[model samples]
Target: MNNDFKNNAIRGPINAFMFKVLSGYMDRLFGKSKRQLFRNHPETVVEIGSGTGANMRYLKPGTTLIAIEPNIHMHANLKKSADKYGINLEIKAIKGELIDLADNSCDFVVSTLVLCTVKSPEQCVKQIKRILKPSGTFIFIEHVKAQKNSILRWIQNIMHKPWHWFFEGCHTNRDTKQVLELAGFSSLKLVSYNLYSPFIPIVSQIRGRAIK
Candidate 1:
């Protein structure tokens, strides 16, 4: 499988279908906690890579949401989901690296399962930091590189290229936590956990907030 197949075959229809099936479970597992992290209702919220608007349902009342989704194929569903959920959303069909917002414009930035696939993760973070208010918050949930010397770690290394090709440029082993911290977040907080399965062992995960 190549990048084309990954985007057309896997990322479009299949990815949307899979999300439809798994979103409820995902919400139950992690979405609630993420919502709690933003309970204070930021006036301006920007969710990068808001695929199908899964996070739309979690937005707090009176928040003005900017949903950035680079893929055109996902836009319709994203709009439908936002409308269905009654969210105050503005859709932007653009990449995270070129966020069409002014400096210090947004109060909160969010990314969930998105950093791994962005063309330049560091650039995305830099843009986020640029647009965020001085006291703004950046919240993220990402699957990352496994523990050193572990079987899963070795597997991730071995499958790196193939996995990227199969999953629309998603790297299985990015050190995204460190990337965010290095991107100049003022106060950073993150925690790691694992989701082990027969097919994929020790799938490492991280979720937290970085205050700018």
Candidate 2:
């Protein structure tokens, strides 16, 4: 196992359990948007940070889903969900910053709420672009920083440390939108919205696709 993977063993299981428990509620909050964005995804798609396979429900049965998940603890539940969904699941115990795919080898890549947790959002997005076939799209839904000078922003700043610690390095105020825009995609389309959930630190969210 990678050192990073081993180091996270203690917190990894706790995070995995939390995601498993909250998967249904999260789906309820983001299901519609996920369905809209995931519609007609290719037969084989790559998904970054596929925790507990929460997005599996949005994919068609028999779809080939290559899940990039670094946390070993999430794999068991993720596999269970894949079986339930009839997906052809391939698990890669790797981080998004260093994907092991060939250049232009993938047609589509998907991510949901992953950017905030990656060690380097820029490197992750770069890897996404590198592996995508020309004109291929990277679909994503990520929580971002609340507007500057807003009360919510203040709360995000205050809660940042604890949130990061509890969530295994998830940033409470990551500027994911900016990272995508600067990734040099051929074209990008994004929508910003608030998820009216109790998780206020992650309420400000964005979802869209960037074409390579």
Choose the strongest candidate by lDDT: 2
lDDT of 2: 0.90
Per-residue lDDT of 14-85 in model 2, one digit per residue for the tens? 889999999989988999999999999999989999989999999999999999998889999999999999
The global C-alpha lDDT for each of the candidates, from Candidate 1 onward, is 0.77, 0.90
Candidate 1 global TM-score:
0.88
lDDT by residue for model 1 (28-104), tens: 77766677766775667799888777887787655677988766666777777867777777888777888889999
Model 1 lowest lDDT segment of ten: 1-10
**Once model 1 is optimally superposed onto the true structure by TM-score, how far is the C-alpha of residue 44 displaced, in angstroms?**
2.7
Best by TM-score: 2
